[model samples]
Each structure stands twice: as C-alpha cells, then as structure tokens.
Target: MGYESYQQLGVDVADGVATLTLRSGQKFNAVTWQMHHELGLIFDDLTRDPDVRVIVLTGAGDAFCAGADLNWLRNQLQDPPTPREAREAGRAIVLGILDCPKPVIARVNGDAIGLGASLALLSDIVIAVDTCKFADPHVRIGLVAGDGGALIWPLLIGYARAKEYLLTGNAVPAADAVRMGLVNHAVPAGELDATVQRYARQLADGATMAIQFTKTSTNIPLRQAVESVLEASLAYESMTLRSQDAQEGVASFLERRKPNFVGR
Candidate 1:
C-alpha cells in the first residue's frame, strides 16, 4: 500500500519482509484510537499476503512510541470508553499480534513506553537499540496494565521483576533489559536496523512451516494466559476510566504536573 493509504501507520514490503512503521513522527508516535484500529487492519491484511515471510514493526522517526496520544486521552476522558469498545480494541491488538502466522520482530529504535513496551514484549523477537528504554506506567495513571503488559512482562522477566517495574513505572535500559531476558538483543543505535534486517532475512530464508509451527506451539501458553485475564483487565481498565483518578491522570499529563488523585 502507498503512504497515502495509511493515516497512522506506514506499510512497505521488500525481500519477503513486511515492515509496519508507526507514522506519528517525533511526537513519540503516540497511538490514537484510530491508529489502534488501523493496526488491526494492517495485521489482517498481512495475514492474507502469501509472499510476506517475516514482519518487522518499528516506529517512524526517533521514538518507538509514547503510549496513548494526549489528544486521544482528552477525548476519551470527555467520553468514557465503553466496556465493549475496550474489550474489542484490547483483544484485537493482543490477538492480532500474537496470532500472526509469520514471525514478528520488534525493532525498538528508541524509547518504548506503555503500550509501546507491551508491543515489543509481545513480538517473537525484540532487538532494541542501546539507547532504548522500556517501561509500563499504568499504575502511575491509576490504571491496570490491561493491554499485554500484565500478561507478557511476567512471562519475559518473571513475576517479581515484572511487578516491580509495572508498579514503579521505572524505565529499563536496553542492556539491563537484555540481561533480564526481556529482549533478545541490545545493539548500538546505528546497528539496530541492520541487526533486525539480518534476523528477518534469516527467518525469511528458513523453512516457513517450521518457523510458523514453532511460533504457534511456543505461544500456546501466552495465548491461554491472555484469554484468561483479558476480559477482567479490560473491564477494570474501562471502569477506571470512569473514576476521578483516571480523569486526574489525563489532566496531570496534559498540564505537565503531578496528579492529585483522590482515589475515588
């Protein structure tokens, strides 16, 4: 598809690899609700394309993503998200990435916060730049880590470490992330693209069925775990959207100040 065809993402295919670039530019590539919808559609389209052997996902410009867009959050605050929308969007994102038949590689070029971190963790292999940082700050916003964070982080780095990072919302450096087994590799910023491409090419040249089947087999536990907690966490996240703390969280973020959450 041409660049004009996408509003929030850019898609390009070459050498049996399909690259999905988050197109929000340097404003940290924050995802709007529309972008989430488009992402689901992108994956759906990719699933049907036979020539595509590997998928590489990265953000356009500097940062990978900064989580939800501030403008989108403001709108969502004014009109609280319905449970139906929450459940559907959440399921679409997690399932779309997890169930992809092709091997997905996350090329974390820079900081990946919130949903961005979750996306990286969900990928079959994650290669992050040395300068990259990962964090999930859902608790800081008085919300649960509904979208993949709660489900994937523990599987990657163990429950104790995952809980510490999630609760504290502290950033994890790329080297430390690799050491903790949160990422497959951490290379210099300049080598990030080449490294991901190299890996992608290797996968593309390998036995397609073997790679696909192995990926499917490995993801069974994750798929089951996500299914078990998805509904409850999504519902809880939506309920929090209606709370005073959620409103405060958005307002504080917009105002560039600490939130005075009343915990209603």
Candidate 2:
C-alpha cells in the first residue's frame, strides 16, 4: 500500500522478524490521525503474515514519538467528532496493538510522551535508553487521560502509582520507569538499538506458534479490562473535541502560551 503522508511507518520482515520504524524526523515523530489509521491497517496486515514471528517498533530520529500532531489536534477541534467515528478510531488503534499475535517490543530511542507512552506500555517488552523519558500530559492540557493511558497504566503499575503519574503528568525517567514496572529494561543510550535487536532476533528464532499463543493468552485479561473503559473514554474525548477548552488547548500549544480554558 502507498502512503501519501510525510510520516513513513512500515514493516520490514527478515529472518522471521519484522521491524516497524516510525519515520518522522526530528519533530519527535509526532503522529497524525492518518498515521494512526495507517498503523491500524499495518497491524491488520501483520496479523495475516505467517512469516513474521517477532515485531519491533521504534522511531527513526533521536526521540521516539512526542505524541499527536498539533495541527491534527487543531483540525480535530475545528471539525468536532461524531460518536461512532471517535469510538471506531480509538478502539481500532488500541486493539490493533493489543491483539497482535506476535510478541511486540518497543525500542525507546528517546523521549516518549502521551500516545507514545501508550505505545510503549502496550508492547510485550519495552527497552529504553538511560536518557529516555515517559509521560502522559493529557491532564496538563485540560483533557482526560482518555487514550490507552487510563486502560493500561493501572494494569502495569497498580492503581495508586498510575494515579500519581496520570494525575500529575510528570515525566518518568528511564531508571525510574523500570523501578515502577513501567518498562522491561533500561540500558545505555549506545546499547539501546543492539539490546532491542538481540531480543527481537531471539523471539524470531524461537517457536512461532508457542510465542504467539503465549502473548495472546497473557494479554486476554488486559484486553478485557480495557474494553469498557476505552469505549467510554473515547466518547467523552470526542465530546470534548467540540468544547472550547480543547480549542484553547490546541491554540495555546501552537501559540506557546498558557490556555485560558473556561470549561466550555
């Protein structure tokens, strides 16, 4: 399939391992709604590819992904959103990653924020560099932690710790994230790429059916827990797309000024 958008994310299968690289240079790999939709399609394709045994997700530049595109956010605010569209888009993206049969690993090359953090947490294993940081600043932007944050963080780090991080929108350093059970391992910056490659190759060389089945089985409970919350949150988040606060949030971000959200 051909993609017109500037962002380039694709599958490269070799030796039973498929590497998916998010190629949006230096702007921290910010994602657009089209990119999210493309990701869903890519995941669907991967599900049918029997040759692929392991999947690795990483970014091209120094940072992994900073999150949603500011321009996309602005357009979303301007157009608002229908309930059906919201639910479909939100569920498709989250479930695509959650339901992938093969083990998925996140190679956190650098900072991962908002939806980026969600991607990292959803993976079967996450390898982060010492300089890498993770955060969900949804609340800071006057929005609920509506994406996978609400659904996955609690499961990964328990209710209390998840609440602390989500509520505060604080940045969690690599070492601190590992200690809090948010990431699988933390390695040196120079070793991050090799570390991820080693793990992905190992899984690729292992029993295909066994690995895929094990991943699916382990993720069943998580998928169940997220189903309802994801449905509800997507509706609420869509409703906000029409609100003045969301508009102000986007404008403030682009203008580099504090938002004057009046809770419209």
Candidate 3:
C-alpha cells in the first residue's frame, strides 16, 4: 500500500508495468538486510496492485545486484539470527516470488552474485547485458547457497552444471548463461533497456488470465521445491553463519584477501 515508503527499492508503475528497482546503485545494488526483507514484501504488493499487469525487477545502475551487503554479513558474525529467523526470512523472499501471479522479468544490467544470482534465476524471464555475469558465491564466503541458489540453479541449468557453478562460485558470463539455459537472452548493453521494455510491454498487453494462470502452473515445482528444500537449506546456512569459517570469510572479504578457511 505504501510503495513510496520503501527506502532501498524504487517502485515505478507505468501503463501496467511495475518496475521494482534495487536503488543502492553506488554499491552495485548490493542488498542490505532491510532490502532483503523488503524484497519479500514488495512482490505481494505488486501482485495485488490492479494496475500492475507485469513486474520488472532491475537494478538502478550498471550492476544488477552484487550480493548481500558485506556490512550486513559482518554484523551477522557478531549478532547472528536464530535458525527460525533465517528460515522464515529466506522462505518469505522465495515464496513471495514464486507465489506472485504476474510475469516477472529480471533486467540484469550487471553482475548477479550470490543472492543476486538467485533473484535473477527466480524470475519468469531473465534478460541480461552481454557484459554481465551470474554467480552464486556463497560457498566462496564459507556459507551454503541456501537462499534460493541451490534450488533455482538446478532447476534452470540442471544438476551437473548447477553443482559445478554452485560449488566453485565461478562467474558465468552472460553469453554462457544464455547458452546454458540459465537466462532467456543476453543483449548488448545498449539493447538491454529496450529489450526488457519490449518484453514487459508484450506481457502487460497479453491475455491476463491466461498468462497469470500459466505462470502459476509453471511455478508449481518451484513452490514444492521451496517447501521441501528451503527450510533445510536456510537452516544449514544459519549453522554456517555461526561458524569460524564464515567469520573468516567475511573478514577476508572486507580485508580484500583470499579467505583462509580452516573448515571449522
């Protein structure tokens, strides 16, 4: 109801297209704890907004979403959320996206790392700039890829490839992502905006009931996956959050050095 009150997300609706943008451009639209909670709530509001026939998720600047805010990660080391809190928050975001009836298009303008990568893969259609990359680097930070990465990656790219990327945290180029079936298209930087706009308009103008119904049907497996897998994943991630390796990982990232994980 109060879209204007959102501090980290920029909400703009025009001609049935609601574009929800991650507004922290200076930090490559990296997500903060506040932004993460908002992401789980905004989709439901957009879905309820009668004028919003299609939803477009994008970043304000060049980067789509870099990942979680390192400051937030550091804070987690000191004041970790309980497992229940972690599980619920993670479920809210993933379930929110899967539950939304409107077609969601991800406008990946730049690199999508960790949670960023999961967000992109969750969308119904993902279009990225050719220069951008996608990766779930939670493992690199000594954490599990629990926040939708493990589930969605395998769904989009299959088990072997998903395992490889998730395990290695390698950044997959946009072209390779498209070829691997991780995203729908990869266009030149100049074409990204226009391309996404075109798709949005098409979906906005298409058969509403049919499209919404189709999206709901398409997400059945995703919803089931959320039910079956998300709880355990988030729980494990929470466990890792309390580990010395996770602390070292955040410290190394902040120090701009390779993490020396002792696997504690």
Candidate 4:
C-alpha cells in the first residue's frame, strides 16, 4: 500500500513500525476535512502493508490534535453533509481504528483535545507527556461527543466521570488522566518519545500473531458497543451541527468570547 497519495497525514514505515503523523502543525494538527478523510482510509492501508507490524500515531509539532478545524466546521453549517453521509464518515474512522489488527500506540506529545482525545483513547496503548492535557470539548462547541467519545470514554473511566467531563467540557490533566485510566502512562516531556518507542519496539519485535490476535479478541466487545450506539450518537451530532446553539458556540469560540447558548 503506497501512502504517498495522502495529503494531510505523513506516513513512514521502517523496521516493522509505521509512524503516522498528523501534519497540520500550523493549526495544531487540527482535523481538517482532508485529514479526517485520510485518517478514515490510512489505517486500512497500514493494516495491509506487509512490513508494518506496529503503528505509532502522533502530531507534527506541539499538540497531538486540537480536534476539528473549527473554521472548516463553521463552513459546513451552510453545506452540512446528510445524516447518512455524516454517520458513514464517522463510522469509517471509528471502525478503521477498532478493526485494524495492528497494535496502535498514541504518542501524545502535547494536549489532546476533542477528537484528539478520542483518537488517543481509542489506541491500543496511550502514552502522554505529563504537561499535556486531555479533553473532549465537543459539548463546549455544542456538538455531540459522537466520533468515538460517547463510546470509549465511559468504558475507560466510568459513566459518571465521562459525563462530568464531557458535559462540562473540562480538561483532564495528564496525571489525573493516568489515575483515571484514560491513558497508560504519563511521563515527562523528555521521556515521551522513548516510552512510546520502547512499547512500539516491544510490540513490533514480539510474536506478531499473538499481539495482533489479542488485540482482535479485546476489540470484539468494542465493535459490539459501536454497533449498539455509534450510529445514534452520530445522527444526533449531525442534527446538533445544524442547531442554533452550535452556531453560537462556533462563533463565540472563533471570536474569543462567551457563548450565550439559547437552547433550541
């Protein structure tokens, strides 16, 4: 599988490890439509590549991912995708990660926000820097935590904890994230790379079939969870994207002001 076709993601494979970097550092590696579309496709390609035994997902510059490109999202208000299109797009990315047989490690070098947090939480192993924070501020922007948040968060922490953070749009510090079981390890900034590489190398050089099959076995329940809830969440998200409060949320965020959300 040739990854040269992708525009927003940088793909490099060497010594049984494939590193996929979100390349839009200028925007804090936010998820542009192109990035989102490519992400939904790249995992499948990596899954089939013969030399790729493990995958490391990270960002180019500072933040792991700041979530959706708000400007692009704002534009989508006038030209929103149909509910079916939205559902399928969201499903592709979610299932792509869940169904991939390879072990995926999230090297969260910086803050993981919104969809960014979802990406890290979905990985097989998540390692972050102690200075970084994890947040899924979907509701802050008047959006449903539909992408993978509603499915994964409660399973990682608990229903009460998930709701407290998701509803309030609060940021979870790295130390708390580790304590809450949101991530595997939170090391100092200098240790982030080494920790991720060590884990990736171990998984890469170990018995590949056992690691892959174990991941597959564990993901069975996740796939079942996806089937039960992901679509409804996505559909609700699609509807919310067209809501009056969402418009205010985006506008306020871009303008750097408080949003006066009028429930609609």
Q: Can you give the lDDT of residue 35 in candidate 1?
A: 85
Show where candidate 4 strays beyond 4 Å.
Answer: none
User: Which consecutive 10 residues in model 4 have the weakest lDDT in total?
Assistant: 23-32
Worst 10 residues of 2 by lDDT: 1-10
Which regions of candidate 1 deviate over 4 angstroms? 1-4
Q: For residue 260, what is the lDDT in candidate 1? A: 93
Once model 3 is optimally superposed onto the true structure by TM-score, how far is the C-alpha of residue 34 displaced, in angstroms?
1.2
Local accuracy of candidate 1 as per-residue lDDT tens digits, 1-264: 344567888878898899989876538899888787887677767777887899999999888988888788778878987899888888888888888889999999889998899888999999999988999998777777887788888889999999999888899999999999999999998898899999999999999999999998999998898878777788888888788888888888888899998988
TM-score of 3: 0.98
Off by over 4 Å in 2: 1-7
* Alpha-carbon RMSD, each predicted model: 1.4, 2.0, 1.0, 0.8
Comparing 1 and 2 by TM-score, which wins?
A: 1
- As for candidate 2, its clashing pairs are none
What would the per-residue lDDT of candidate 3 be over residues 1-264, giving only the tens digit for each residue? 459878899999999999999986448888898899899799889988999999899998777999999998899889999998998899988888889999999999889998998888999999999999999999988999999998899988899999999999998999999999999999999998899999999999999999999999989988888877787889999999999999999899889999999989
lDDT of 2 by residue, 1-264 (tens): 223342568567888777888765438988877677777677777777877788898887687889888887788777866889777877877888889888899999989898889988898999999888999987666677777888888988999999999888899999999998999999998888889999998998888889889999999998897778788877777777778787788788889998898988
What clash count does candidate 4 reach?
0
Give the winner by lDDT: 2 or 4: 4
Task: Compare candidates 2 and 4 on TM-score and give the better one.
Answer: 4
